[model samples]
Target: MSGMINLIKMELFRLVKSKGTYLTILFVVIFSFLLFMMSSSFGEQSKANMLEEDNALYAEITEEEEHIKSGGIGFVGVDFTRDTDIKFETIVHSFLSSGVFLIFCGIFAANTVCNKYKCGFQKNLSTYSNKKWQLTASENIAVLAFTVTEILLIVFILLIISVFYFENFRLGSAANIIKYMGMQAVLYYAFATLIMFIVEVVHSKVAGITVTCLLSMGFGSFFFNKLDEILKLNNFLVTQHTIVYNAKMLPIAFDGELWGTAATVAICSIILYNIFSAFFVSSRDMA
Candidate 1:
Protein backbone atom coordinates (compact mmCIF):
# COMPACT_ATOMS: atom_id res chain seq x y z
CA MET A 1 0.00 0.00 0.00
CA SER A 2 2.75 2.43 0.90
CA GLY A 3 4.62 1.62 -2.28
CA MET A 4 1.54 2.33 -4.33
CA ILE A 5 0.92 5.59 -2.53
CA ASN A 6 4.52 6.72 -2.98
CA LEU A 7 4.33 5.89 -6.66
CA ILE A 8 1.14 7.89 -6.96
CA LYS A 9 2.83 10.90 -5.41
CA MET A 10 5.60 10.73 -7.98
CA GLU A 11 3.01 10.55 -10.74
CA LEU A 12 1.29 13.65 -9.40
CA PHE A 13 4.59 15.53 -9.34
CA ARG A 14 5.18 14.71 -12.97
CA LEU A 15 1.76 16.05 -13.91
CA VAL A 16 2.47 19.24 -12.01
CA LYS A 17 5.39 19.96 -14.33
CA SER A 18 3.30 19.89 -17.48
CA LYS A 19 2.48 23.41 -18.61
CA GLY A 20 -0.13 22.25 -21.09
CA THR A 21 -2.04 20.38 -18.41
CA TYR A 22 -1.97 23.36 -16.06
CA LEU A 23 -3.11 25.70 -18.80
CA THR A 24 -5.94 23.38 -19.75
CA ILE A 25 -7.27 23.10 -16.19
CA LEU A 26 -6.99 26.85 -15.61
CA PHE A 27 -8.77 27.60 -18.86
CA VAL A 28 -11.57 25.22 -17.98
CA VAL A 29 -11.93 26.81 -14.57
CA ILE A 30 -12.32 30.26 -16.09
CA PHE A 31 -14.78 29.07 -18.69
CA SER A 32 -16.89 27.12 -16.18
CA PHE A 33 -17.06 30.08 -13.83
CA LEU A 34 -18.26 32.42 -16.54
CA LEU A 35 -20.89 29.99 -17.78
CA PHE A 36 -22.02 29.12 -14.27
CA MET A 37 -22.42 32.79 -13.42
CA MET A 38 -24.68 33.23 -16.40
CA SER A 39 -26.81 30.19 -15.63
CA SER A 40 -27.06 31.00 -11.94
CA SER A 41 -28.73 34.29 -12.77
CA PHE A 42 -31.65 32.31 -14.09
CA GLY A 43 -31.59 30.09 -11.01
CA GLU A 44 -31.70 33.15 -8.78
CA GLN A 45 -34.63 34.51 -10.69
CA SER A 46 -36.43 31.21 -10.29
CA LYS A 47 -35.92 31.33 -6.56
CA ALA A 48 -37.33 34.84 -6.48
CA ASN A 49 -40.36 33.71 -8.42
CA MET A 50 -41.01 31.06 -5.78
CA LEU A 51 -40.96 33.71 -3.07
CA GLU A 52 -43.56 35.86 -4.86
CA GLU A 53 -46.18 33.12 -4.53
CA ASP A 54 -47.86 34.51 -1.41
CA ASN A 55 -51.18 34.50 -3.21
CA ALA A 56 -50.16 31.20 -4.76
CA LEU A 57 -49.86 27.70 -3.29
CA TYR A 58 -48.51 28.64 0.11
CA ALA A 59 -51.28 31.19 0.61
CA GLU A 60 -53.90 28.67 -0.49
CA ILE A 61 -52.44 26.24 2.04
CA THR A 62 -52.95 28.87 4.75
CA GLU A 63 -56.59 29.40 3.67
CA GLU A 64 -57.14 25.65 3.63
CA GLU A 65 -55.75 25.41 7.14
CA GLU A 66 -58.27 28.04 8.32
CA HIS A 67 -61.17 26.16 6.72
CA ILE A 68 -59.93 22.80 8.06
CA LYS A 69 -61.10 23.86 11.52
CA SER A 70 -62.47 20.29 11.21
CA GLY A 71 -60.45 18.08 13.58
CA GLY A 72 -57.16 19.86 12.66
CA ILE A 73 -56.94 17.48 9.66
CA GLY A 74 -55.86 19.94 6.94
CA PHE A 75 -54.57 18.90 3.51
CA VAL A 76 -51.51 21.08 3.74
CA GLY A 77 -49.10 19.15 1.55
CA VAL A 78 -51.42 19.10 -1.49
CA ASP A 79 -51.75 22.86 -1.46
CA PHE A 80 -48.09 23.40 -2.41
CA THR A 81 -48.55 22.42 -6.05
CA ARG A 82 -46.28 25.24 -7.22
CA ASP A 83 -43.38 23.47 -5.55
CA THR A 84 -43.40 21.24 -8.61
CA ASP A 85 -42.81 24.23 -10.88
CA ILE A 86 -39.95 25.51 -8.73
CA LYS A 87 -38.36 22.07 -8.82
CA PHE A 88 -38.55 21.99 -12.61
CA GLU A 89 -36.90 25.37 -12.95
CA THR A 90 -34.11 24.26 -10.68
CA ILE A 91 -33.60 21.13 -12.76
CA VAL A 92 -33.36 23.10 -15.98
CA HIS A 93 -30.73 25.48 -14.65
CA SER A 94 -28.76 22.60 -13.14
CA PHE A 95 -28.81 20.66 -16.38
CA LEU A 96 -27.41 23.60 -18.28
CA SER A 97 -24.67 24.16 -15.74
CA SER A 98 -23.67 20.48 -15.68
CA GLY A 99 -23.69 20.10 -19.45
CA VAL A 100 -21.21 22.92 -19.96
CA PHE A 101 -18.92 21.75 -17.18
CA LEU A 102 -18.83 18.08 -18.20
CA ILE A 103 -17.54 18.89 -21.69
CA PHE A 104 -14.44 20.34 -20.11
CA CYS A 105 -14.04 17.35 -17.79
CA GLY A 106 -14.11 14.96 -20.73
CA ILE A 107 -11.56 17.08 -22.57
CA PHE A 108 -9.37 17.20 -19.52
CA ALA A 109 -9.44 13.40 -19.22
CA ALA A 110 -8.50 13.05 -22.89
CA ASN A 111 -5.58 15.40 -22.53
CA THR A 112 -4.17 13.89 -19.36
CA VAL A 113 -4.03 10.32 -20.61
CA CYS A 114 -3.30 10.96 -24.28
CA ASN A 115 -0.73 13.69 -23.81
CA LYS A 116 1.17 11.75 -21.14
CA TYR A 117 2.06 9.09 -23.69
CA LYS A 118 2.19 11.37 -26.72
CA CYS A 119 4.93 13.35 -24.98
CA GLY A 120 7.09 10.25 -24.24
CA PHE A 121 6.62 10.08 -20.48
CA GLN A 122 5.66 6.44 -20.71
CA LYS A 123 9.10 5.22 -21.74
CA ASN A 124 10.79 7.43 -19.16
CA LEU A 125 8.48 6.10 -16.48
CA SER A 126 9.32 2.51 -17.37
CA THR A 127 13.07 2.96 -16.92
CA TYR A 128 12.66 3.07 -13.15
CA SER A 129 10.73 -0.22 -13.04
CA ASN A 130 9.22 -1.51 -16.25
CA LYS A 131 7.36 -4.47 -14.85
CA LYS A 132 3.84 -4.56 -16.27
CA TRP A 133 2.20 -4.59 -12.85
CA GLN A 134 4.24 -1.64 -11.63
CA LEU A 135 3.76 0.27 -14.85
CA THR A 136 -0.03 -0.14 -14.75
CA ALA A 137 -0.11 0.89 -11.13
CA SER A 138 1.81 4.08 -11.80
CA GLU A 139 -0.29 5.05 -14.78
CA ASN A 140 -3.50 4.51 -12.81
CA ILE A 141 -2.14 6.62 -10.02
CA ALA A 142 -1.32 9.47 -12.36
CA VAL A 143 -4.75 9.44 -13.92
CA LEU A 144 -6.43 9.27 -10.51
CA ALA A 145 -4.49 12.29 -9.28
CA PHE A 146 -5.38 14.31 -12.31
CA THR A 147 -8.99 13.27 -11.97
CA VAL A 148 -9.33 14.27 -8.30
CA THR A 149 -7.64 17.63 -8.82
CA GLU A 150 -9.81 18.66 -11.75
CA ILE A 151 -13.03 17.55 -10.02
CA LEU A 152 -12.42 19.56 -6.87
CA LEU A 153 -11.39 22.52 -8.96
CA ILE A 154 -14.64 22.38 -10.87
CA VAL A 155 -16.61 22.31 -7.61
CA PHE A 156 -14.86 25.45 -6.47
CA ILE A 157 -15.80 27.14 -9.72
CA LEU A 158 -19.49 26.36 -9.14
CA LEU A 159 -19.32 27.61 -5.56
CA ILE A 160 -17.92 30.91 -6.74
CA ILE A 161 -20.79 31.43 -9.15
CA SER A 162 -23.37 30.46 -6.52
CA VAL A 163 -22.12 33.18 -4.21
CA PHE A 164 -21.57 35.98 -6.70
CA TYR A 165 -24.66 35.41 -8.84
CA PHE A 166 -27.34 34.35 -6.39
CA GLU A 167 -29.09 37.12 -4.50
CA ASN A 168 -29.61 34.88 -1.48
CA PHE A 169 -28.13 31.43 -1.39
CA ARG A 170 -30.12 28.74 0.36
CA LEU A 171 -28.15 26.15 2.23
CA GLY A 172 -30.48 23.33 1.22
CA SER A 173 -29.90 23.75 -2.49
CA ALA A 174 -26.20 23.05 -2.03
CA ALA A 175 -26.89 19.32 -1.98
CA ASN A 176 -28.05 19.47 -5.57
CA ILE A 177 -24.83 20.98 -6.77
CA ILE A 178 -22.89 18.44 -4.75
CA LYS A 179 -24.83 15.58 -6.31
CA TYR A 180 -24.00 16.74 -9.81
CA MET A 181 -20.36 17.16 -8.94
CA GLY A 182 -20.12 13.60 -7.61
CA MET A 183 -21.90 12.23 -10.67
CA GLN A 184 -19.51 13.99 -13.01
CA ALA A 185 -16.53 12.89 -10.96
CA VAL A 186 -17.50 9.22 -11.02
CA LEU A 187 -18.37 9.30 -14.71
CA TYR A 188 -15.14 11.06 -15.63
CA TYR A 189 -13.06 8.67 -13.55
CA ALA A 190 -14.39 5.77 -15.60
CA PHE A 191 -13.87 7.79 -18.74
CA ALA A 192 -10.26 8.51 -17.91
CA THR A 193 -9.55 4.87 -17.20
CA LEU A 194 -11.34 3.69 -20.30
CA ILE A 195 -9.89 6.35 -22.59
CA MET A 196 -6.37 5.75 -21.38
CA PHE A 197 -6.56 2.05 -22.07
CA ILE A 198 -8.53 2.37 -25.29
CA VAL A 199 -6.16 4.84 -26.89
CA GLU A 200 -3.18 2.96 -25.64
CA VAL A 201 -4.43 -0.14 -27.47
CA VAL A 202 -5.30 1.67 -30.71
CA HIS A 203 -1.91 3.44 -30.50
CA SER A 204 -3.44 6.66 -31.76
CA LYS A 205 -4.08 9.24 -29.05
CA VAL A 206 -6.31 11.49 -31.14
CA ALA A 207 -8.28 8.60 -32.57
CA GLY A 208 -8.82 7.06 -29.15
CA ILE A 209 -9.98 10.28 -27.53
CA THR A 210 -12.29 11.16 -30.40
CA VAL A 211 -13.96 7.77 -30.43
CA THR A 212 -14.40 7.92 -26.65
CA CYS A 213 -16.18 11.26 -26.75
CA LEU A 214 -18.50 10.11 -29.51
CA LEU A 215 -19.33 6.86 -27.77
CA SER A 216 -19.82 8.50 -24.41
CA MET A 217 -22.29 11.04 -25.72
CA GLY A 218 -24.06 8.88 -28.27
CA PHE A 219 -24.34 5.61 -26.42
CA GLY A 220 -24.64 7.13 -22.99
CA SER A 221 -27.73 9.04 -24.08
CA PHE A 222 -29.29 5.91 -25.45
CA PHE A 223 -28.73 4.15 -22.15
CA PHE A 224 -30.32 7.04 -20.30
CA ASN A 225 -33.18 7.40 -22.77
CA LYS A 226 -34.21 3.78 -22.33
CA LEU A 227 -33.29 3.09 -18.75
CA ASP A 228 -35.68 0.18 -18.20
CA GLU A 229 -33.82 -1.91 -20.76
CA ILE A 230 -30.66 0.08 -21.54
CA LEU A 231 -29.78 0.51 -17.88
CA LYS A 232 -29.05 -3.16 -17.70
CA LEU A 233 -25.41 -2.55 -18.69
CA ASN A 234 -24.72 0.73 -16.96
CA ASN A 235 -22.05 -0.58 -14.60
CA PHE A 236 -20.24 -1.99 -17.59
CA LEU A 237 -20.17 1.40 -19.26
CA VAL A 238 -18.58 3.31 -16.33
CA THR A 239 -20.56 6.35 -17.46
CA GLN A 240 -23.81 4.95 -16.10
CA HIS A 241 -23.68 4.43 -12.35
CA THR A 242 -22.09 7.58 -11.03
CA ILE A 243 -24.33 9.65 -8.76
CA VAL A 244 -23.19 13.12 -7.81
CA TYR A 245 -22.88 13.79 -4.07
CA ASN A 246 -24.84 17.01 -3.84
CA ALA A 247 -27.95 18.13 -1.97
CA LYS A 248 -29.47 20.33 -4.65
CA MET A 249 -29.03 17.90 -7.52
CA LEU A 250 -31.34 14.93 -7.86
CA PRO A 251 -29.77 11.63 -6.85
CA ILE A 252 -29.44 8.82 -9.35
CA ALA A 253 -30.61 5.33 -8.50
CA PHE A 254 -28.73 2.63 -10.43
CA ASP A 255 -29.34 -1.07 -10.68
CA GLY A 256 -26.72 -3.15 -8.94
CA GLU A 257 -26.38 -5.63 -11.79
CA LEU A 258 -25.69 -2.85 -14.24
CA TRP A 259 -22.91 -1.37 -12.14
CA GLY A 260 -21.37 -4.74 -11.44
CA THR A 261 -21.33 -5.77 -15.06
CA ALA A 262 -19.92 -2.49 -16.35
CA ALA A 263 -17.31 -2.43 -13.63
CA THR A 264 -16.19 -5.91 -14.67
CA VAL A 265 -15.92 -4.85 -18.29
CA ALA A 266 -13.87 -1.79 -17.48
CA ILE A 267 -11.60 -3.72 -15.14
CA CYS A 268 -10.88 -6.39 -17.70
CA SER A 269 -10.35 -3.88 -20.45
CA ILE A 270 -7.93 -1.94 -18.26
CA ILE A 271 -5.86 -5.07 -17.65
CA LEU A 272 -5.57 -5.98 -21.32
CA TYR A 273 -4.98 -2.39 -22.27
CA ASN A 274 -2.01 -2.09 -19.93
CA ILE A 275 -0.62 -5.36 -21.28
CA PHE A 276 -0.78 -4.23 -24.90
CA SER A 277 0.43 -0.75 -24.11
CA ALA A 278 3.33 -2.31 -22.20
CA PHE A 279 4.72 -3.73 -25.42
CA PHE A 280 4.98 -0.31 -27.01
CA VAL A 281 6.71 1.21 -24.02
CA SER A 282 8.90 -1.72 -22.93
CA SER A 283 10.06 -2.58 -26.45
CA ARG A 284 10.15 0.77 -28.24
CA ASP A 285 13.39 2.70 -28.44
CA MET A 286 12.97 5.96 -26.51
CA ALA A 287 14.69 9.27 -27.12
Candidate 2:
Protein backbone atom coordinates (compact mmCIF):
# COMPACT_ATOMS: atom_id res chain seq x y z
CA MET A 1 0.00 0.00 0.00
CA SER A 2 2.80 2.36 0.86
CA GLY A 3 4.62 1.45 -2.35
CA MET A 4 1.55 2.21 -4.43
CA ILE A 5 1.06 5.56 -2.71
CA ASN A 6 4.71 6.45 -3.17
CA LEU A 7 4.59 5.52 -6.83
CA ILE A 8 1.48 7.63 -7.34
CA LYS A 9 3.15 10.57 -5.61
CA MET A 10 6.24 10.20 -7.78
CA GLU A 11 4.15 10.06 -10.94
CA LEU A 12 2.22 13.19 -9.97
CA PHE A 13 5.41 15.05 -9.08
CA ARG A 14 6.85 14.21 -12.47
CA LEU A 15 3.62 15.26 -14.18
CA VAL A 16 3.71 18.63 -12.42
CA LYS A 17 7.31 19.24 -13.45
CA SER A 18 6.95 18.12 -17.07
CA LYS A 19 7.04 20.81 -19.76
CA GLY A 20 4.61 18.86 -21.92
CA THR A 21 1.94 19.16 -19.24
CA TYR A 22 1.98 22.96 -19.41
CA LEU A 23 2.29 22.90 -23.19
CA THR A 24 -0.82 20.76 -23.46
CA ILE A 25 -2.74 23.10 -21.17
CA LEU A 26 -1.60 26.07 -23.26
CA PHE A 27 -2.77 24.39 -26.45
CA VAL A 28 -6.16 23.70 -24.87
CA VAL A 29 -6.58 27.38 -23.97
CA ILE A 30 -5.65 28.53 -27.47
CA PHE A 31 -7.97 26.00 -29.01
CA SER A 32 -10.84 27.08 -26.76
CA PHE A 33 -10.42 30.72 -27.81
CA LEU A 34 -10.34 29.84 -31.48
CA LEU A 35 -13.41 27.65 -31.14
CA PHE A 36 -15.35 30.41 -29.42
CA MET A 37 -14.42 32.95 -32.12
CA MET A 38 -15.37 30.64 -34.96
CA SER A 39 -18.63 29.61 -33.32
CA SER A 40 -19.56 33.21 -32.61
CA SER A 41 -18.80 34.33 -36.18
CA PHE A 42 -20.89 31.52 -37.59
CA GLY A 43 -23.71 32.32 -35.24
CA GLU A 44 -23.76 35.95 -36.36
CA GLN A 45 -23.90 34.94 -40.01
CA SER A 46 -26.68 32.49 -39.33
CA LYS A 47 -28.67 35.09 -37.44
CA ALA A 48 -28.29 37.51 -40.34
CA ASN A 49 -29.48 34.92 -42.83
CA MET A 50 -32.50 34.13 -40.67
CA LEU A 51 -33.41 37.80 -40.44
CA GLU A 52 -33.27 38.17 -44.23
CA GLU A 53 -35.50 35.17 -44.75
CA ASP A 54 -37.95 36.40 -42.13
CA ASN A 55 -38.12 39.82 -43.79
CA ALA A 56 -38.82 38.23 -47.16
CA LEU A 57 -41.58 36.10 -45.61
CA TYR A 58 -43.10 39.19 -44.01
CA ALA A 59 -43.27 40.88 -47.40
CA GLU A 60 -45.30 37.92 -48.71
CA ILE A 61 -47.66 37.72 -45.70
CA THR A 62 -49.49 40.97 -46.65
CA GLU A 63 -51.28 41.19 -43.22
CA GLU A 64 -49.74 42.11 -39.89
CA GLU A 65 -52.32 40.04 -37.99
CA GLU A 66 -51.54 36.95 -40.11
CA HIS A 67 -47.79 37.46 -39.64
CA ILE A 68 -48.18 37.78 -35.88
CA LYS A 69 -50.21 34.59 -35.81
CA SER A 70 -47.53 32.79 -37.83
CA GLY A 71 -45.00 32.55 -35.00
CA GLY A 72 -43.93 36.23 -34.95
CA ILE A 73 -41.37 36.00 -37.86
CA GLY A 74 -38.75 34.45 -35.65
CA PHE A 75 -36.78 31.41 -36.83
CA VAL A 76 -36.11 28.47 -34.55
CA GLY A 77 -33.30 25.97 -34.95
CA VAL A 78 -30.10 24.66 -33.40
CA ASP A 79 -27.89 27.51 -34.61
CA PHE A 80 -26.40 29.61 -31.81
CA THR A 81 -27.71 33.09 -32.48
CA ARG A 82 -27.42 36.18 -30.34
CA ASP A 83 -31.10 35.85 -29.54
CA THR A 84 -30.53 32.36 -28.31
CA ASP A 85 -29.70 32.21 -24.63
CA ILE A 86 -26.25 30.69 -24.27
CA LYS A 87 -25.51 28.45 -21.32
CA PHE A 88 -22.19 27.33 -19.89
CA GLU A 89 -23.32 23.71 -20.08
CA THR A 90 -24.06 24.03 -23.80
CA ILE A 91 -20.64 25.53 -24.45
CA VAL A 92 -18.96 22.76 -22.50
CA HIS A 93 -20.85 20.12 -24.48
CA SER A 94 -19.75 21.67 -27.77
CA PHE A 95 -16.11 21.84 -26.74
CA LEU A 96 -15.88 18.29 -25.47
CA SER A 97 -17.98 16.67 -28.21
CA SER A 98 -15.60 18.20 -30.74
CA GLY A 99 -13.19 15.28 -29.97
CA VAL A 100 -10.22 17.62 -29.55
CA PHE A 101 -10.21 17.08 -25.79
CA LEU A 102 -9.91 13.32 -26.17
CA ILE A 103 -7.09 13.71 -28.64
CA PHE A 104 -5.12 15.84 -26.26
CA CYS A 105 -5.76 13.49 -23.37
CA GLY A 106 -4.60 10.50 -25.40
CA ILE A 107 -1.42 12.24 -26.52
CA PHE A 108 -0.67 13.30 -22.97
CA ALA A 109 -1.17 9.77 -21.68
CA ALA A 110 1.03 8.28 -24.37
CA ASN A 111 3.80 10.72 -23.62
CA THR A 112 3.52 10.19 -19.87
CA VAL A 113 3.81 6.44 -20.16
CA CYS A 114 6.35 6.32 -22.94
CA ASN A 115 8.71 8.85 -21.39
CA LYS A 116 9.47 6.61 -18.44
CA TYR A 117 10.49 3.77 -20.72
CA LYS A 118 12.51 6.13 -22.89
CA CYS A 119 14.52 7.33 -19.91
CA GLY A 120 14.99 3.90 -18.27
CA PHE A 121 12.92 5.17 -15.36
CA GLN A 122 10.59 2.20 -15.51
CA LYS A 123 13.46 -0.19 -15.12
CA ASN A 124 14.82 1.70 -12.15
CA LEU A 125 11.39 1.71 -10.51
CA SER A 126 10.98 -1.99 -11.15
CA THR A 127 14.22 -2.77 -9.32
CA TYR A 128 12.79 -1.30 -6.14
CA SER A 129 9.52 -3.23 -6.37
CA ASN A 130 8.68 -6.72 -7.50
CA LYS A 131 4.95 -6.02 -7.89
CA LYS A 132 4.71 -4.67 -11.44
CA TRP A 133 0.95 -4.37 -11.17
CA GLN A 134 1.38 -1.74 -8.50
CA LEU A 135 3.29 0.42 -10.93
CA THR A 136 0.53 0.11 -13.50
CA ALA A 137 -2.13 0.88 -10.92
CA SER A 138 -0.26 3.90 -9.57
CA GLU A 139 0.49 5.40 -12.96
CA ASN A 140 -3.09 4.93 -14.09
CA ILE A 141 -4.43 6.60 -10.94
CA ALA A 142 -2.08 9.53 -11.47
CA VAL A 143 -3.08 9.95 -15.09
CA LEU A 144 -6.75 9.80 -14.16
CA ALA A 145 -6.13 12.54 -11.58
CA PHE A 146 -4.55 14.68 -14.25
CA THR A 147 -7.47 13.97 -16.56
CA VAL A 148 -9.90 15.32 -13.97
CA THR A 149 -7.75 18.41 -13.52
CA GLU A 150 -7.72 19.00 -17.25
CA ILE A 151 -11.49 18.71 -17.40
CA LEU A 152 -11.82 21.29 -14.64
CA LEU A 153 -9.41 23.61 -16.40
CA ILE A 154 -11.35 23.32 -19.63
CA VAL A 155 -14.63 24.18 -17.89
CA PHE A 156 -13.04 27.19 -16.19
CA ILE A 157 -11.60 28.54 -19.43
CA LEU A 158 -14.82 28.01 -21.34
CA LEU A 159 -16.83 29.64 -18.57
CA ILE A 160 -14.63 32.71 -18.71
CA ILE A 161 -14.85 32.93 -22.50
CA SER A 162 -18.63 32.45 -22.54
CA VAL A 163 -19.15 35.21 -19.99
CA PHE A 164 -17.55 37.69 -22.40
CA TYR A 165 -18.97 36.22 -25.60
CA PHE A 166 -22.65 35.86 -24.83
CA GLU A 167 -24.92 38.86 -24.20
CA ASN A 168 -26.91 36.92 -21.59
CA PHE A 169 -24.85 33.89 -20.75
CA ARG A 170 -26.18 31.56 -18.05
CA LEU A 171 -24.52 29.08 -15.80
CA GLY A 172 -27.39 26.71 -16.50
CA SER A 173 -28.46 23.98 -14.10
CA ALA A 174 -25.61 23.26 -11.73
CA ALA A 175 -26.66 19.67 -11.08
CA ASN A 176 -26.95 18.93 -14.79
CA ILE A 177 -23.50 20.27 -15.59
CA ILE A 178 -22.00 18.30 -12.73
CA LYS A 179 -23.61 15.11 -13.97
CA TYR A 180 -22.52 15.75 -17.55
CA MET A 181 -18.94 16.54 -16.54
CA GLY A 182 -18.77 13.56 -14.26
CA MET A 183 -19.80 11.23 -17.07
CA GLN A 184 -17.27 12.77 -19.45
CA ALA A 185 -14.52 12.55 -16.86
CA VAL A 186 -15.12 8.83 -16.51
CA LEU A 187 -15.05 8.34 -20.27
CA TYR A 188 -11.85 10.37 -20.53
CA TYR A 189 -10.21 8.33 -17.80
CA ALA A 190 -11.02 5.20 -19.74
CA PHE A 191 -9.49 6.77 -22.83
CA ALA A 192 -6.33 7.66 -20.94
CA THR A 193 -6.01 4.17 -19.55
CA LEU A 194 -6.47 2.69 -23.00
CA ILE A 195 -3.65 4.87 -24.28
CA MET A 196 -1.45 3.84 -21.37
CA PHE A 197 -2.18 0.19 -22.09
CA ILE A 198 -1.17 0.62 -25.71
CA VAL A 199 2.04 2.41 -24.76
CA GLU A 200 2.95 -0.17 -22.17
CA VAL A 201 2.31 -3.12 -24.45
CA VAL A 202 3.97 -1.75 -27.59
CA HIS A 203 6.86 -0.33 -25.59
CA SER A 204 7.58 2.06 -28.49
CA LYS A 205 6.86 5.76 -28.30
CA VAL A 206 6.32 6.20 -32.04
CA ALA A 207 3.95 3.27 -32.43
CA GLY A 208 2.05 4.17 -29.28
CA ILE A 209 1.60 7.75 -30.40
CA THR A 210 0.53 6.73 -33.88
CA VAL A 211 -2.11 4.35 -32.54
CA THR A 212 -3.32 6.92 -30.02
CA CYS A 213 -3.73 9.55 -32.73
CA LEU A 214 -5.68 7.23 -34.94
CA LEU A 215 -7.98 6.10 -32.14
CA SER A 216 -8.45 9.62 -30.84
CA MET A 217 -9.38 10.82 -34.33
CA GLY A 218 -12.22 8.28 -34.51
CA PHE A 219 -10.66 5.81 -36.92
CA GLY A 220 -11.38 3.04 -34.44
CA SER A 221 -15.04 4.01 -34.32
CA PHE A 222 -15.14 4.26 -38.12
CA PHE A 223 -13.80 0.74 -38.46
CA PHE A 224 -16.37 -0.55 -36.01
CA ASN A 225 -19.21 1.20 -37.84
CA LYS A 226 -18.02 -0.26 -41.10
CA LEU A 227 -17.91 -3.71 -39.60
CA ASP A 228 -21.42 -3.38 -38.26
CA GLU A 229 -22.60 -2.47 -41.73
CA ILE A 230 -20.70 -5.27 -43.37
CA LEU A 231 -21.90 -7.80 -40.86
CA LYS A 232 -25.44 -6.49 -40.93
CA LEU A 233 -25.68 -6.08 -37.19
CA ASN A 234 -29.09 -4.48 -37.21
CA ASN A 235 -30.14 -2.41 -34.23
CA PHE A 236 -26.76 -2.93 -32.71
CA LEU A 237 -23.95 -0.72 -33.94
CA VAL A 238 -20.54 -1.69 -32.70
CA THR A 239 -19.55 1.95 -32.94
CA GLN A 240 -22.11 2.94 -30.32
CA HIS A 241 -20.32 0.74 -27.83
CA THR A 242 -17.02 2.56 -28.20
CA ILE A 243 -15.65 5.31 -25.97
CA VAL A 244 -15.22 7.75 -28.86
CA TYR A 245 -18.81 7.34 -29.96
CA ASN A 246 -20.13 7.66 -26.43
CA ALA A 247 -18.17 10.85 -25.90
CA LYS A 248 -19.70 12.32 -29.02
CA MET A 249 -23.22 11.18 -28.20
CA LEU A 250 -23.21 12.39 -24.61
CA PRO A 251 -25.84 15.12 -24.33
CA ILE A 252 -25.72 18.22 -22.18
CA ALA A 253 -29.24 17.45 -21.02
CA PHE A 254 -29.28 14.34 -18.97
CA ASP A 255 -30.77 11.21 -20.50
CA GLY A 256 -31.09 8.18 -18.29
CA GLU A 257 -30.38 5.63 -21.03
CA LEU A 258 -27.35 7.45 -22.39
CA TRP A 259 -26.01 8.04 -18.92
CA GLY A 260 -26.31 4.36 -18.13
CA THR A 261 -24.63 3.44 -21.41
CA ALA A 262 -21.73 5.82 -20.87
CA ALA A 263 -21.20 4.62 -17.34
CA THR A 264 -21.20 0.96 -18.33
CA VAL A 265 -18.84 1.48 -21.26
CA ALA A 266 -16.40 3.60 -19.25
CA ILE A 267 -16.32 1.29 -16.27
CA CYS A 268 -15.84 -1.80 -18.41
CA SER A 269 -13.08 -0.20 -20.42
CA ILE A 270 -11.23 0.92 -17.32
CA ILE A 271 -11.42 -2.50 -15.74
CA LEU A 272 -10.34 -4.35 -18.87
CA TYR A 273 -7.47 -2.03 -19.68
CA ASN A 274 -6.15 -2.15 -16.14
CA ILE A 275 -6.25 -5.93 -16.12
CA PHE A 276 -4.51 -6.21 -19.48
CA SER A 277 -1.91 -3.61 -18.54
CA ALA A 278 -1.20 -5.31 -15.23
CA PHE A 279 -0.92 -8.71 -16.85
CA PHE A 280 1.56 -7.52 -19.44
CA VAL A 281 3.60 -5.64 -16.88
CA SER A 282 3.77 -8.62 -14.60
CA SER A 283 4.78 -11.05 -17.33
CA ARG A 284 7.34 -8.88 -19.13
CA ASP A 285 10.75 -7.87 -17.87
CA MET A 286 10.87 -4.11 -17.35
CA ALA A 287 14.61 -3.84 -18.04
Which number leads on TM-score?
2
Candidate 1, residues 213-266, lDDT tens digits: the string is 444334344444366465566334333332211111223333365444444444
* lDDT per residue as tens, model 2, 93-139: 76676566776788788888888888888867755456989888988
Model 1 stretches with alpha carbons more than 4 Å out? 1-7, 37-100, 125-130, 173-183, 219-287
**Native-to-model Cα distance after best TM-score fit, residue 62 in candidate 2, in Å:** 30
The candidate scoring highest on lDDT is: 2
Q: List candidate 2 segments past 4 Å from native.
A: 52-83
Residue 236 in model 1: shift from native, Å? Answer: 12
- Tell me the number of clashing residue pairs for each predicted model: 17, 0
Looking at model 2, residue 119 earns an lDDT score of 87
Full-model lDDT for every candidate: 0.50, 0.76
Model 1, C-alpha of 279: deviation from truth (Å): 8.5
Model 1 has how many clashing residue pairs?
A: 17
